[model samples]
Target: MPVHDPYAWALDFEALGLVPAVGIAYSLALRRYPAERWRIACFAAGLALILAAFVTPLHTLSMHFLLSAHLLQNVVLAEWAPALCVLGLPPALAAAACRRSVVGTLTHPLVALPLWLGTYFAWHVPAAYDAALRHPTSLIHVEHGCYFVAGFLFWWPALQNAPHRLSGGTRALYLFAAFVLAAPLGLLLALIPRAVYDFYVHAPHRIWGLSPLADQQIGGAAMALEQASVLFAASTYFFLRFLGGDERAEAYRSLQRSS
Candidate 1:
């Protein structure tokens, strides 16, 4: 059975447009600065992939009622979408954009921190999930936007690709804390015995005809997998930096001893 309206899927291209628009706007605004084209390309490509996922038959087919299909959708939204968006950040452009008074205030860790947390919580709420299913196109815009912003903020510290550059140790600590904080949420979702979202529970859609509970479990798994990817990548980078710092310190001590 069809999970979504074809018309709704077609209209969803607007969500994809925002990614390039934001990227281009930032690029043009900071054209004078030495920019990273690779990062811009990653950002643009990520948005394009997300738009392709939803606007094509992939989204409808996945929503048709299979745990794996549902999991794929979650991966696209939570993991792949965010990762690509962050990869496109050029430190110079970020610094330029941060010069704007309002942008600086909003991107401040204090503000971005809570917004990230709120976006995570709000989308997972049962009501919100149901609303997203009913109004697929509009909710997609909101969902993808949240993912993009959250990813950008999360990467800010580690990449130092933002207006604010945090010390290596600080970035490491942030990554650690984020991993610890998000673990319980993933566990909670994974442990749920039944479908939490009403739309999935009641909808006639079925991928390979899997049950709604299974689909929900798959969604939880997707969240866990994405978190694991972020934690592993960030931790690896931090560890390498830490080891290099230690080596430098050891070399300095050897020189002092020789002198």
Candidate 2:
């Protein structure tokens, strides 16, 4: 009976509050340390993407109507934004954060990988996802929070200095395993004959006449491709590093030292 305005660009006033909060937090946290401009830019870009996903019409669509939009939000929160935020951390800051005993204990590839996969898959189960959608607004935030944290956990062990150091070859294999194993759920959702979750069936208006199921399928495909692209690029980096031998490895290590 109701149609959403496809051009709707604004809603969720509370979401706008996040940008200044994050900016202030970042400024205060790193105030003592002079951060590189590029790192600051990365962090700013990550924040901007997050704001776009939640503060704009995307939030209205995701929270009230469409699963596809929600999935896109999840991708931004779980992967793109968090990765950039982590990368933006200065090397000393990153090392210090990673060295915390709790971080040390949990961020090992073995622990982090399983934890990430479990959280990711568990949340995608129809009952779980639908519950998040149906419950109090706080539940939605919780769901997104879990996804964000899990993503960071999964990615951190590879990029930062961890307690159990992985060799370049091992890192490559680890990334390959992670990306490959995490992909099938999305692929299945994308190709399934029927909609896997019923939550979005009544989503207000169809975008371009795409049915709810089609939207879900599109979301799944987007998830698969987005992650595949990121993982492929990262895997290449690690694989190339693995092939570079100790001489090249040491040379790069030295550059890191000098920075």
Candidate 3:
């Protein structure tokens, strides 16, 4: 792709401002509650992912070039980055932040899961998706903003130990259910013979020589693969924790009976 004055290869500054804003907040939090090295690393990694998604040419490509690129960007905003950022929070910070009644209620699995799913599916609807792309500067930002916020809420019940934490078994079930519910969207997109979004169908130039249908399929497959990997890994971790807790409980009972 040629580097034109305004094109897919251009850098997007729309989300660039958030980097400094989030950095300042993190810096202040660090001063008050010293985070562990791993936490700091996770937080830094999350920010880096955000930059790669929105600050680089990838963001422009997503907006103009390929459906696969756009789907990959969405995955980062809605899953990978949010999970790491949530994991990066210090214990004290997480507790204090989640302590609010509104926060607790919103982040509860019952509430968060549906909201996240709704946002995911609603935005992917052809009409909405096309509209967002049509008004890239305005509606697209709104679309991405919703994804980011919902992502944080979606991961909170599974990751945080404050205000309201799910049991290991519940967390595993929560994640498993999320995967089951959300997987079909990707499958539908991949399996559909025709391109879902008109914007991509009418794109000025096809960068990778991929037909619209092929590009859509690739994007859909990527979405499914990412969700399966990230969600399944988290679910397995919690499920193992559940099993370990059960085994420990049984051991304690055995010791009590022996005494």
Q: Against the true structure, what is every candidate's RMSD? A: 4.9, 3.0, 3.7
Model 3 TM-score, 2 decimals = 0.91
Model 2 TM-score relative to the real fold: 0.87
Kindly indicate the candidate among 1 and 2 with the higher lDDT: 2
lDDT of 3: 0.86
lDDT value for candidate 1? Answer: 0.65
What is the lDDT of every predicted structure here? 0.65, 0.78, 0.86
- Per-residue lDDT tens digits for candidate 3, residues 224-244, read 988899898889999998988
- When 2 and 3 are scored with TM-score, the better candidate is 3
Provide TM-scores for the models.
0.77, 0.87, 0.91
| lDDT of each residue in 68-187, candidate 1, tens digit only | 454466557655666676666666666777788766766665666566666777776888766766775577557756765675665555565466666556667767666666665666
Q: Model 2 Cα displacement at 236 (Å)?
A: 1.4
Cα lDDT tens digits for candidate 2, 145-234: 788788877777777654566777777787788889889877888998887666787555566677877887988998898778887778
Q: Give lDDT: candidate 2, residue 54.
A: 75
- Rank the models by lDDT, top first: 3, 2, 1
* Candidate number of the best lDDT: 3
